[model samples]
Target: MTEKDFIPKRYSESMEHGSVSWEAPSNIALVKYWGKKEHQIPANPSVSFTLKNCRTITRLDFSKKENQSDFDFEIYFEGNKKEDFKPKIKTFFERIVQYVPFLKEYKFEIHSENTFPHSSGIASSASGMSALALCVMSLEKKLNPEMREGFFRKKASFLARLGSGSACRSIEGDLVVWGKHQETRGSSDLFGIKYPDEVHENFKNYQDTILLVDKGTKEVSSSVGHNLMHNHPFAEARFAQAHENLAKLKPVFAEGDLEKFIEIVENEALTLHSMMMSSRPYFILMKPNTLEIINKIWSFRKRTELPVCFTLDAGANVHVLYPEKDKVKVLEFIKNELVAYCENGHYICDSVGDGALKLK
Candidate 1:
C-alpha cells in the first residue's frame, strides 16, 4: 500500500536515460472480450487487433533526490498537473519496485498522458497503461540487463492490472490475451488465432466507425464490476459464453466471411452487455440511440445482407464494423439516420491501428 509496505529489496541500482516513451494503440474486439475468471485476467483468453488511428503515448524519467527516501508518481491530463490520482499510482510504483527489487532505492517520476477522452471510454486504459508498462519495462532494461522479456511481461501485467483491467491486454498486440495466471506458467494453450495477426490482413478491407453516443460514463468501473464477480452467480456463464464465442468466431474472421463474423460479433456484443445487466448493482450503458442503430443494422442485414454490425464496450458508443468499400454508404448512413435517431449529431470514424511502440 506504501513504500513501507514493500518487503525490502533484493537488488538495488540507479541509472539515467534521457527518457523513454511508447505510443500504444487501443483495440476493439471484433469477436468481443468479456467477463473474467480472475478479476483483471482474461476469462477466456480474448484477442484483439490494435487500432491504427488512436493511441496514448507515455514517458518516464528519473532523478536522484538528495533529501527524499521514497519514490513519487505524477500524472497529467492533457496539459494540467494532476497528483490526486497518486495514491493508487504510488501503490503501483511500489509493486513495480518490490517485484524488480533492483529499483527499490532509486526515485521515479512517471509521466503519462492519453490523447483521447480523459476517462470517457473508447479503450483509453487499453493504450494508456500499455504505453506505461512498456515505458517502465524499458527503464528496467536500461538499468538491469539480466531481466528477460518473460520476466517483464508478467511483471508489467501485474502492475498495469491494478490500474485498469483492460491494461493487461494492452501489453501485446495484433492478437493479445491477458493469460490466466494459472495458464501462463508454461501453458502454451492460453489463446488461439485463426488469422495471422497482421495489420493489413485482418483490417485493411474492414472499417469500424465509432458512433459516440454520450452515456456520461458508467456508474461502476470495470474494477468494481470485476470485484462483483466474486458474488455474481452468472459470472461463470458469461465466461463460458465468451470462450465458446471466441473459439467459433476466430475461424469466421480468418475466412474473411463477413456475414459469419458479424453474426458472431453481434452475439458476443450482446453477451457482454448481458453481464453488465446481470451484475448486482445492475446497470445498462445502452441508449435509445444504441438500439436504434442496432435495429437499422439488423434491417439492413435483412434487406441488403451487408456485413455491418454493432459492438459496445461498457458504454453507449456504438462501434459499427463495416467494409471500407462501403465508406460512402457508411458515412451517409451515419449522417442521415443518426440525425433522425442518434444521441448526438457528432461522431468520429477510426480505422484499426498499430500496436504499442516507441514513436519515430
Candidate 2:
C-alpha cells in the first residue's frame, strides 16, 4: 500500500507542540507465519499471545517547524541517538504521511526504550512499531476530535502493519490473530484482531520465560528468511498445515486442552525452523543451546507431569510457556536447569498482557 491510499478527506488543520507516549508489548506466535505477500501481508494466518514486561515504551515530542516538504524527526533509543533506526521510521512516515499531513509541518523528538535488550531473540519490531503507531494515532485524534477510540486502534494496527507485518498483532491484548482465514471471522490480511473471549481461561495469564540462548543478532534476518520461502519446496504445504493447525487450535483453546496446546505450539515452532532449513539456500537459526533447552523442557514436563512447552521465534532463544498455576514449579525448573543454557543465565519472565497502554 502507498501513502496515497491512507490520506484522509480532511487535513486542513494543524496543531501546536505536544507529546504522546505509549507502551506496546511484544508477541509470541503460537502459529508461526513464515512467509508474506504484497504490502507485508502474511502468506499464512498466525496467532500469538501478547506479552507483558517485554515491551517498548515510546514518546513522540512534536513541535511546529518551518515549512518542510518531508517529515522532520529524530529518534533516540534509551536516551541515545539511533541513526540506524531512522531509515525505517522515515520510510514508515513516508508511507503514512497522507493520513497525518501535519507530520510535515512539525519537528519530532522521539524517545523509545525497550524493556528487554535488543537482539535478544525477542520480537522488538512488534513492540516498537506498535508503540509508534499508537503515538501517531493519538496525535491524529487530537487533531481530529471526531475520531472514535476503536477506529483509532484499528488505524494504528493498520499503520503498524505497514512498518512490520507482525507488529499489527501487538495492538491488541491476551491473544491476537492476523491474516484472513476461511473459518475465522473478523480476521483480515491488513491488520490483526484480538482473539475471541470464548477461549478458556486456562490459556489466559500464561507465563513465558524467554531463555536468552544467544544475545547476538540473528544470522539470517526475518525478511531474508521470508524471501527464501519463495523457492522453498514445502512452502505451499507449510501454508496449508498452518491453516489446519489454526483450525484445530481454536477448538483446543476453547476446550482448555493443554495437551493439544502443547502439541500445536511446539509443532509450529519446529515447523518454522524446518522451513528455514529446507529452503533453497538453507540456514539454521537455532543454536545448540536452543535444542538443549527444548530437550530439557520436554524431559522436565514428562517427569513432573507439568503442562509446559517451548516455542521459538526466528532466532535462537527459547520461550518457555506454562499456565499461571504452574508458575512456581516452572520457575524452579527454569532456575535449576534452563538457566545453564541461557546466555549468562539471563532470561525475561513475562506473561499475557492487556494490550498496549497510553501513558498519561
Candidate 3:
C-alpha cells in the first residue's frame, strides 16, 4: 500500500494542549519474522496472535513549545523516571518527525507501564512502542479532526514499526500479519494488517500461558540477533521457507486444523533459535529447562492426546498455547508438571485479545 492508502488531512487549527493514552497488547509470531532490512521492513512475512493481559499502557501529555526542532519530553515508567528509555524515544521521535509535523510545537510528558516483566522473554518493545504510537496518533487526530479511522491505525502502525518491527503487529487485535505476500491483500512491509475474517471460529480465544523459565535479562539483544542474520548461511532458504509456511498456515487458520497448527507453530519456534545458533558469532537463548519443559509438554500431549503446543520468542521462557476448551486440563498439567521448570513457579495466563485501545 502507498501513502494514498491512508490520507490524513492537513489541519489549519492547532491544539494548544492535549493528552492521549492507549493500551496495546504484545504478540507472538506463529510464522516468525526473524530477519529484516532497512527501515524495519521484514525480510519475510509473519503471522501472530495478539496476546491478552500482557500489554503496555502509555499516556502522552503535550503542550505547545516555541521554535523547537528536536523532541522535548520526560518519560516515566511505573511511577519511576526512566532516563535510560529517553535515548530510544528520542531516536523514534527523530525517525517519525517528518510524518508528524506538529511534534516540533509540543513538549511532552510520557508515562508508560507494562503488565508483564520487561525483558523476561515477552516482547516489551512491541507493546511499549505500539502503545506510544497509539497515544501520539490519538493526539494527532485531535489536532486534525478529519483524520479517518483507517488512516489513524495505519499511521500508528507505521510509526510503531520505526521503533520496533513487531510493534506494528501490536496495533491490531486477534491475528495480525506483517510483510508483503502475494496472497494477502493490503499486506505491507511498512505496517501490519489484521488477519482476514476467513479465520475459523475455533481458532478464536486461543490460550497462551507463558512459563517464565528465567526472569533475567537476555544475553544477546534482539537487535544484535537481527544483525547476525545478515550473513546467515540459511538466510535465503529460511526466508523462502517462511513464505511457504505462511501460505500453508492460512488454510489451517480457516479450517481450524489443530494438528497442522501445532506442526507449523512448533517448527517456526525452533527455526527462530536455529537461525541464531547458525549465525557466525552465534548465541543460545534457550536454557536447559526450556528443553525439559518442551519434552514434558510433548510427552503429556502424547499421553492425553491434547492439542497443547509450545513456542518461544528470543528468550528462554516458553509460551504454552492451546485452545480454551482444554483450559482445565492444561492448567492442571501446568500446576502439577510444568511449574517446577519455571523460575520461582512464575507464569502468566493470557489469551487472544482485542488489539489497542484508545483511552477516553
Highest TM-score scorer: 3
Cα lDDT tens digits for candidate 1, 79-116: 67778766756766665655555444445556677666
Q: 1 or 2: which has the higher lDDT?
A: 2
- How does each model score on lDDT? 0.63, 0.90, 0.90
Q: Which stretches of candidate 2 lie over 4 Å from their true place?
A: 1-6, 11-13
For model 3, where is the 10-residue window of minimal lDDT?
3-12
Judge candidate 3 against the unseen true structure and give its global Cα lDDT, from 0 to 1.
0.90
Which candidate leads in lDDT?
A: 3
- Best to worst by TM-score, what's the order? 3, 2, 1
Displacement of the residue 251 alpha carbon in candidate 3, Å: 1.2
Q: Write the per-residue lDDT of candidate 3 for residues 62-151, one digit (tens) a residue.
A: 999886867789999998999999999999988887777677789999999999877555769999999998988887888788778998
List TM-scores for all candidates, in order: 0.82, 0.96, 0.97
Arrange candidates, best lDDT first. 3, 2, 1
What TM-score would candidate 3 get against the native? 0.97
What are the runs in model 3 whose C-alpha is more than 4 Å off?
Answer: 3-9
Query: Candidate 1: TM-score?
Result: 0.82
